[model samples]
Target: MTNATAPLDFIRPEVDRALQRFVDRRRTAFDDPDLAAVLGTVRDFLAGGKRLRPAFCYWGWRAAGGADDPGVISAASALELLQASALVHDDVMDSSDMRRGMPSAHRRFEKLHVDSGWHGSAVQFGEGAAILVGNLLLIWSGELWRNSGLPAESLASAQPVFDHMLTELMNGQYLDLLAQAHGENSFESARRVALFKSGKYSVEHPLRLGMILAAQSREAWIDQVCAGYGQNVGIAFQLRDDVLGVFGDPAETGKPAGDDLREGKRTMLIARTLELASPAQAQSVRALVGDPKLDAEGVATLRTVIEDTGALASAEELITTYVKEAVAVLDAAPIEAEAREALKALAIAATTRRN
Candidate 1:
């Protein structure tokens, strides 16, 4: 199960296979034709993703002395299902058109509505469909975790961490919605939202999940070390996401160039820009950055202001600080050498990747 040469090479394909079999069985059990389309949507949504949470969970287990068991991988793969639920609901909330270079689940439902000549409002139907599909994914995620074929005791040990991980994700997402609604853009607020909504779910909890599944050590301090590393790396990961939302290439990012700006996201980048930009520049940015119909020229102007104010550099520096903090934790933790190296690689990838 353990491949010291390439820690993740065996994981990704095995995880994908596990997901395929899980979904196929579900598809078989739920045979309603109307349910069929929603199941299909959920399947497709789960098909393509970076699978970061599962990766972290796998390594965390390894670091905690869990062997390379397909059951561990299957349990870890449950994170992807939960992630799909989050993303689908998020796209619905954001009213996004695309995800990973294709129509978002809600948008696809909208098209289905229009194509089929449904009675009710297409937009409403799309949103409803998105919500239903998201709920289904969440349910299936729990199913995978509970029935992963891991030992009963291991599943029991991991349950609390798993439950809290999702609860934090939901709370964080709500905080994000509030930040947008209130038009809040302070760095503190942004960080709080990022920590709960993304940092914990994406990194912290997943690592903790793996650690719990291992049930190797009941010591409290070991859990702290894992959490510390996960939290810092999670912050760095979210920081990278915020930076990419504004500056990443649409082709690579699979999002509109100024999607975050248009969505009025109160990210660190925007908060820093507000702090550093000249009064007039700040005023102009405030007026246009959040407009739903923000244009290319508007995005260009905001980009210029962001660059001139050095907000981008500041954000990058913050990311570096978090990454360093995470590395320090890894260096001191009692992890296997190979597992430590894999965890370090995950941290680097989270902070530095463009998309």
Candidate 2:
């Protein structure tokens, strides 16, 4: 790897190369062009991300003094493959048309079906393709984890954490779909969803996996410290995402303005808005939000309601509190100095990231 000229960039290219190499190898398993599209589409879908999970995992390893290990980096990279599966399946579940400012995987396959004049409903073909691709990525995520060149014993130790992470992720998805279906309008429910969906799976588990890989029988307090740190930071990260989904620039967020509102996502922001907004404003918003055909004007109307209700500031305050708590966890954490500073920067970046 040539110089990427940044502390975090050092790990990024290695992860990217691993993903690409893994994808290339997997492509060989399919000889037919149609079958090969699944691998190709997944590769493209995995191209862009902040790679926060992998970074957290890597930094956690460093915190445990397992510095500069190739096996750790490769294993950490596997989290991205898991993330790709989550997002692809998430898009299918949400029926999202776009991802990362491009056509979503399902949409791409749907277009492919229409352009090729293939048999059966284009929607069904597209959804089926996306679901299969998600499953393939899930399968590959495990393979990449196992093939990371770590000692068999060390990898074995991380197995339970990895398995639990996957289980929580799926359960969280079910909760999300359930909440959406029933229009359950509770802030507590949204927070629960965030805790399982993004907090545990995306941040805490990956960080813990790194620590476990580093020392299968490490100190208990150390693991507790990292878990607490990751949990708070992860929740703050997702809340920030909720903010972006509403107020962020479309070009940067890879979604339309107020996309969460349009989706009627029972996010904490929405719940807060509902809690704080006056009865009439709340009534008007409830009427307009989640309308698939809601125009920009309607989005504006809802944005004003959110602002007027003080939900945005409330959310920001919550983020600040969590960041402070996360930082406080590091004060006594049994980690080396250099890696601790790096982790601090990551906490800031994950919270402040624009995309």
Candidate 3:
């Protein structure tokens, strides 16, 4: 391994440029009056995202000895489009009002409805519009992937990964909904969601897709490395997110603190806290766990309870453990030393980042 500032530099500009071109093409091709508004909303949602998945895809391809070609860049950009579609829908499902420092897509549409004095339920209108827009992005993503100009076999090899990624995302969402509804919150259950819903698609699958696109012959090894890497980074990423949902600054994370608590997210932190709490502490946490009206003081108290019960430290320790494991996987991957070093840095950055 050699010195590298970050893997981000390799793909950020490429993905951005590709996305801009795609968006421009959409605008020119679609003459609908709502096109501008839709594009603007999409642009806003995509503006400040870390673009981590696309970067992973790009590096995965490069690490597999892929050339810096237009097809590979476009394929990575398509992954970003798919990610945007998922987020737009995910925010709506979560009833989240903010994302990436702006109103969520549904919220933005709802505001537009109210501001224009449009008839009917502004909330429904916003949600409906956002759903349609998300579907459109999904379609565009598919089109981009199909037209990426890779060799026929390479394109064919990459298709299953794309399909499987979407399936895992949907399954994860379903698991999340079920856990919330049934109050079946447990550490094991949360870990299941984290691995399937987030870890594989967000980190592992993207890397695998990139490798496939690069025509790697050792597909099984690539899968193993990416899975190992993804599991560690993905779980760590969500654990960090669980922490941020409680302790992160609203301005930095673009969401109010304790939002997860309010939503009663069955995250590992919450699960561990519940497990570790005393009878009195357990009752206190259970009483407030799913309450939407939990006040700032109540939220503060819950935070203290979690910390005092050692859940916070436990989650942090898990994050540290996973990050180290991911680094080890990166070290073992049969890639150029430079690529391995970049991936190690990425794993550290992804796990340790505050937002």
Alpha carbon lDDT at 18, candidate 1: 90
Q: Write the per-residue lDDT of candidate 3 for residues 242-347, one digit (tens) a residue.
A: 8888878888888877878888788888899999999999899888877888889989999999999999999999999998998888878887665677777777
Better of 1 and 3 by TM-score: 1
Per-candidate Cα lDDT values, in order, are 0.85, 0.85, 0.83
Q: Write the per-residue lDDT of candidate 2 for residues 1-355, one digit (tens) a residue.
A: 1221233676688889888888887666887876867766887888887788898888888777785888988899999999989999999988888889888889989999999999999999999999998998899899999999999998998898899899999999999888888884778889989989988877788888888888775468767876789888988999999999888998998877877877878888888899898989889878987788888899888889988999999999999999889888987788877777777777787888787
Error of 3 at 222 (Å): 1.3
Q: Higher lDDT: candidate 1 or 3?
A: 1
Instruction: Show pairs that collide, candidate 1.
Output: none
Worst 10 residues of 3 by lDDT: 1-10
Q: What TM-score against the true fold does each predicted structure earn?
A: 0.95, 0.96, 0.95
